[model samples]
Target: METVSGHRPTIIDVAKRAGVSKSTAARALAGASNISDSAREQVLRAADALGYTRNALAVGMRSGRSGMLGLVLPDIANPFWGEVARGAQDRAADADTSILIFSSNRCARKELMHLSTLMRARVDGAIINSVADSLDDLDRFGLPCILIGSSAERFPDTCSVGSDIVQGVGLGMDYLRSMGHERPALIVGQPTRLARARFLRVVHEHCVEHDIDPAVLLIENADYTVEGGRFAMQRLLARNHGLLCVFAANDLMALGAMSAVREAGLRCPEDVSILGFDGIQAGAFAWPGLTTIEKPARQIGAQAVAWLLDGNADAKPGTRVHLPCRLIERGSLANLCDASARRVGSVKG
Candidate 1:
């Protein structure tokens, strides 16, 4: 074999130099399951001599198993999904696999196109956290898929992993009630899917049980942004029900609500307590800090990949794995009833 130093060679170059069929060369390069040791060694030696690296793109086109798991998410700018991606990558590495990512930014069309791309790439599996209305668009793809932060009701045969959002939201309200905040408002994002709807429903149920007027504290449905949070909070505050606190569906809105509180001449925890969902890092740095339910973003990512590796994606569409959440207390919450202060006074005495 004539060798050109410092120049890359193709798979055909490796096959010719290795004295093996192109198919044999391809399988060895792809690290397929059933290749004989002798052929693999020859392919490796020839590949090295020819300065060849496997063209994963070409290999993916020819073979159904690209050894890649594609992760499709809505709004990559959100820190929560970033943690999810990190967890997915870690789990994929543990399984000797790689990941591909596409962000839809909450657009249904973009999400559909990205899924199509993943299919064309021949990815072995996919982990999708779509903002689409339902799994109807997804059902047509016919690929091994796991939906994250989405339900499996329509497609009862696909694997899914998500937070126990109902329980998580309920836990947040329970904390507020315990803290002596009688009139609490909800700042929820526009309901795009089941997850958001369940969160709103759970919060409402808790409000009703506690003798709180559900009408006075209904969620301020708006965009899930800092500005949207501020707007929703402004409207909630105008009602003048002596609302002592507000619970945002996620941390971004929580931060926004905090901003609105300050802008409206109220000190957080003094005039109004604030609570956010999603244990995002930003919550810790916000002025006065934030009390929130810690969403298992990273764990969701890890668990999704684990489920895929465990062959759960192939079982049925509606299979779901709901992970739990915990509460994080911080300066943003102050007991309007002075219960926390009284306890501290008793300790000092």
Candidate 2:
């Protein structure tokens, strides 16, 4: 067939070539299940042959949906967040929808700006893992939204999907105690951050349960980064805190602390044992495999999108979902009961 004179190919051109009505071509192209598979395939083949392209804007206008969702993340560069984004993208693709991802770079202003942009783009909903944004900011986003990560607990009356931090904290504390590390040093963020505060609270509770004195517990405030952990470890070493076991807030900090131990002319699990949270893949391949409580990175992302797209009745405002975390035992932590114990580890370590 010769090209249509003086015009681009349209659904009519495709329908004519496929020997089907225009409405049938439209339904087939839209992936309407009412059409038979054979008909859909035929229309698709004709459209491909004719080089037909969908005007997504027009389609969205007709359907009153943009077929896109917004994802606002604090830091996209982090590997944990990357896994979450991948999970969300995968789930969105399942529903024939796309995701518009924006990184706030841990800035409240930037997060609010991204939300505004998402609104301007007419996204169906948003999934936010904000760092500095307040609950008011989320309310101002004025869209169906689901909070992600530990901070979700800080905001009341909202739908959220996050890892069970309390469960994870207990798991970490229990494992450390089981390893015979009672006075393990804690490396975490400032006391104000809800996640860190929550973690510390659980640690205190665990101490009480195990008949340990919480006041003598070693603690070092660190950023959630390798450099931060390194500096914090260095500071703790300076104090001569007799570090035996150190548990960091995340894998990055734990990895950093490991390097610090070496710099101080000490050996890991020999002079000091280290435990980390966040079972990032790098922990598995570290020099000493790091035992950690693995956060549900991908699950939270997928579940958030699922709740948003599925419109489940129970996924109402104020609904909070906490997926469980698991412990990945590796070589980083030392077993004090072992015959080869290098040193007698104590609680104040």
Best candidate (score: TM-score):
2
| Model 2 steric clash pairs | 158-318, 183-347, 243-349, 244-349
Tens-digit lDDT string for candidate 2 (126-178): 99986754677666656788889877877777788998878998999888877
Instruction: Give per-model TM-scores.
Output: 0.84, 0.91
lDDT per residue as tens, model 1, 1-91: 3456545677778998999998899889777878999999999999887778676766667665677888998888889999999999998
RMSD vs true structure, all candidates: 4.8, 2.9
Residue pairs with clashing backbones, model 1: 156-317, 156-318, 157-316, 157-317, 157-318, 158-316, 158-317
Worst 10 residues of 2 by lDDT: 340-349
Q: How close is candidate 1 to the true structure, as a TM-score?
A: 0.84
Runs in model 1 with CA error above 4 Å? 1-7, 11-51, 151-157, 191-193, 211-213, 337-349
What lDDT does model 1 reach? 0.80
Q: lDDT of model 1 at residue 188? A: 81
lDDT of each: 0.80, 0.84
